[model samples]
Target chain A: MPPDTTTVAPQSVAPSGAPASGRPADDLRTLESGLDALQAVPSTEKGSVRRILEGVLPPVLLLAGLVAVWQLYVVIARPRPDLVPGPLDVLGALGTAWADGRLQLAVLTSLERGGVGFLIAVAIGTPLGLLLAEWRPLRLALGPLLSGLQVLPSVAWVPAAIIWFGLSDATVYFVVLMGAVPSIANGLVSGIDQVPPQLRRVGTVLGAGRIQLATLVVLPAALPGYFSGLKQGWAFSWRSLMAAEIIAMGGTIGFGLGSMLQQSRELADLGSVLATILLILGVGILVELAVFAPIERRLLRRRGLTPGGIR
Target chain B: MSAAPAVLPAIRITALGKRFGADGPLVLDDVTLSIQPGEFVCLLGASGCGKSTLLNIIAGLDAPSTGTVTVASGSAAVMFQDAALFPWLTAGRNVELALKLRGVPRDKRRGKALELLDVVNLADAASKRPHELSGGMRQRVALARSLAQDRKVLLMDEPFAALDAITRDLLHEELERVWRETGRTIVFVTHNVREAARLGQRVLLMSSRPGRIANEWRLADDGPRRIESPEVSRLSIEITEQLRREIRRNAA
Candidate 1:
């Protein structure tokens, strides 16, 4: 970016105690100056493969090792092969189920229920949270209830949802809503609560009234909290959907992976049940990796909230 | 929009009294100050004194308990010790928020923001986030944002206290230059005696807790005086001794 520092005056204040060999955050002013001379290149685009290697490699290796040891223990204990299914047997069962198209449909159905429930949770929970945050009297009256609602298991809501909405998609959605919405709303409420009073004053002094302050300063600062809530809400929604599927009997809300696990259990097929469980766990991880993790990384990076030289 | 700007002193504090609460002791007591247009006044004191409290009152961020702080027209813009640059925005855009608030049209805000960024010699760092920049650079961006308000008065609360000596000194020069160029009345608050000496045209030194103006010094020497200038040194020592006496009296 710079061939010579002879005549060109450096602009902007240098970091404290920085020896600018032009290299920032290190010893050497000339290098720091060289670094300053060197224009900061835009960050490289993070590829899916690179992100996967970054995210999946460590956890995947650990989980694989755990499973391998567990499988070995089972093989040693129950040589009858009834209690122990080797790794290949589970993979082969997964293949066979996929070949039969049951696996895809079940996975797709679960995704749909989870996705719709999550979207609804965000829509309903965000506004409710904002309202609860803005209105002190209402928040005082209902805030404890909201917190209590989050702690109550989603499984607990299934019976009540079934009683109200019957055996239908609506019933499953209702259970998911009950399970997920409180966390999302509370996250926003707490996020709004934690917004610095100084920022609010800045907003107010700049001609912003109550609504604008909430929309501009209050909402953005609350984003870190909002994202965390969304992550937790999705976890709750997925779990709630599975619980709802298990409890509902009469009307077929369609077959999902949870139902397949139930079917495999009734048929006494341990290998198939175990395979279904792996698929559920794999999907859970993949969605977080594919969707939420990237966003979280980006937000953290923008704030310098993430440490450097960790790669 | 059509009314001509009011020509009164940029900020007028009449019989100002502020307390933490109704039952609490007065933090600032019956203080009356009138900041004329384009005047640069430094409120100097030790930590926990009411210098910051006074600046806040002038900015209208906090209300005075028993008095009115009236700005002739347009609200006062503030620069805090922390950059307070809203980490979410780029350096330029942080300044742009002020323009947006002042009712500058959306189309024109970017240009004005850039122009102000140029004023603080930070045009190169316009796109950088607050966290991306170093401490001194962050404060420069903050100074740019404060300038963008285009108000008659700018209230700064120890804006450079967190920075290092070199950066702080550099900013003092930049501030003096900006103060002259902008011709806006400035009420700068700081606990550092040298800093008060360096920047202030008239330095008002406050005593300890339940802070009040113990003495006011009128510096004959002009802008960017050395920290060790005879007049500046003499006044600073005199003020420091008085401040020390005040603190020691309380302790005894």
Candidate 2:
């Protein structure tokens, strides 16, 4: 059994041996500062030059090796120039296209279509994703359908779009939307799903209303996933546009990289065909590195999600 | 300090009870209590005693199945065990978010946030992200954020339970100082007997199995207290014995 009295009488106002007021506070300050300094996260960021080299070197080396192999095959096989063009022939084709400004025009035309299509996809997909995420019954009904649409090749839509729109810009845009919208919407859905329940509770405790919660807490938290989705959406839009341009050629359609490749094929210009493929691949790689890569790196770095020594 | 006779209780609960689902087991039963303004009370119990459930009810995060809880101040702020700081915001901005939600003007928020961070002795760590700060610093930033809510009542659910002993001890001092400085009504829930005896003016021990308030102790002395002090240890030992008895009774 314990003592009957619940209250303990005051023994003393201040203990005889206790540390003085200002001293303990100062000591605590020192101790805490020491702990903070000791446990601080070490900056592992490499120099700018080193980081660039690390990112760019491996791909460059791989491309060089591929070119070497192509030259060796040309030397050994001795095939017809029009059938399997050598690396130099492809370079010459690129040079001719550049000198005549055809390369620039083709690249710009394709890029403009891709950019407009992706912007439209963002406008459509963001709301659709937010709606799907918010309404449970809608999500249950449409979630699987969205995922299925993402897997269905946007290229498969080319013939239907051509039949519907009759070889115009509208046909290209329809194909691009069909390809990009699902991925963007699905990305947002998963991002919203992955937000920690704890964060929602925090927002509520801090007096966030429904709109405030969605705009401030939920949307920002969903950004990383949404961004990746946008990247994938852009890729799909570009691919779908290329497919539309290649198949639905002639009749008020501007010539793009895809049409250029098709033209080279018709003329038996294998070198130009290979050159156009290289140009397409180059555009994809350039967008990924110049636009998407830097943004993703900054996002992950701000959240401390990146592993050490990689920045 | 004692509340004036004319002042109302900071919090009043009447016949509070809670259960999860339609046929779910009762988690809390008949938990009626009143806390005076500026009183520092500890809700001490074993794990699964539904202490957290009672706190949630008072905080208005969970609804009580069979009673009403009234807070005279009309609002309360809570500090959770995990700190729960957003990783994207810096420590200062985390506090500023609460202020912004409270309708503070944009131009004034930064100054107020820095002031709150200063209250927790974290003025210099305002720009550091949650991930950059140590565990103790994160909790301090959380404390600063909760304080920025500027409510008269503060509810804490084992806020220091996850931290190391040395840090927990230091935080106890910081909390006591803050409590004294701000004079807010605090209802702190914890399983640690010594922690209760050290920080609380009154310790309410709750029993398990449809949790109810089983015993209470009042330590009326006004002075600095240490967890390892003989007085604290003596009271902790007494509470532990009563707690063991409650457990044994539940087992039967």
How do the residues A167-236 of candidate 2 rate in per-residue lDDT, one tens digit apiece? 7889899999999999999999998999998898889999999999998899988988898899899999
TM-score, every prediction = 0.88, 0.93
Give candidate 1's whole-model lDDT: 0.78
Q: After superposition, how far is residue B182 of candidate 1 from its true place, in Å?
A: 0.7
Q: What share of the true interface contacts does each candidate keep?
A: 0.20, 0.35
Across B162-204, the per-residue lDDT of candidate 2 in tens digits comes to: 8777677778878988898899999999988888999999999
- Per-residue CA lDDT of model 1 for A1-311, tens digit only, reads 22222121122122344322222222222332344344344555577688668866887799889888978877677654546677777888899999999999999999999999999999999999989998999999999999999999988988888888777888899999999999999988887888788778777766676776777777987888788889899999988888887677558588888788888888887789889999888889888868987788777677656723223
Candidate 1: stretches off by over 4 Å:
A1-52, A63-78, A307-311, B1-7, B221-223
Q: Score candidate 1 by DockQ.
A: 0.23
Clashing pairs in 2: none
Alpha-carbon deviation at B145 in model 2, angstroms: 0.6
Provide DockQ values for all models, in the order shown: 0.23, 0.40
| Residues B12-52, model 1: lDDT tens digits | 77887889878887788777777778888999887777888
Q: Which stretches of candidate 2 lie over 4 Å from their true place?
A: A1-24, A76-79, A307-311, B1-5, B249-252
The whole-model lDDT of each prediction reads 0.78, 0.88
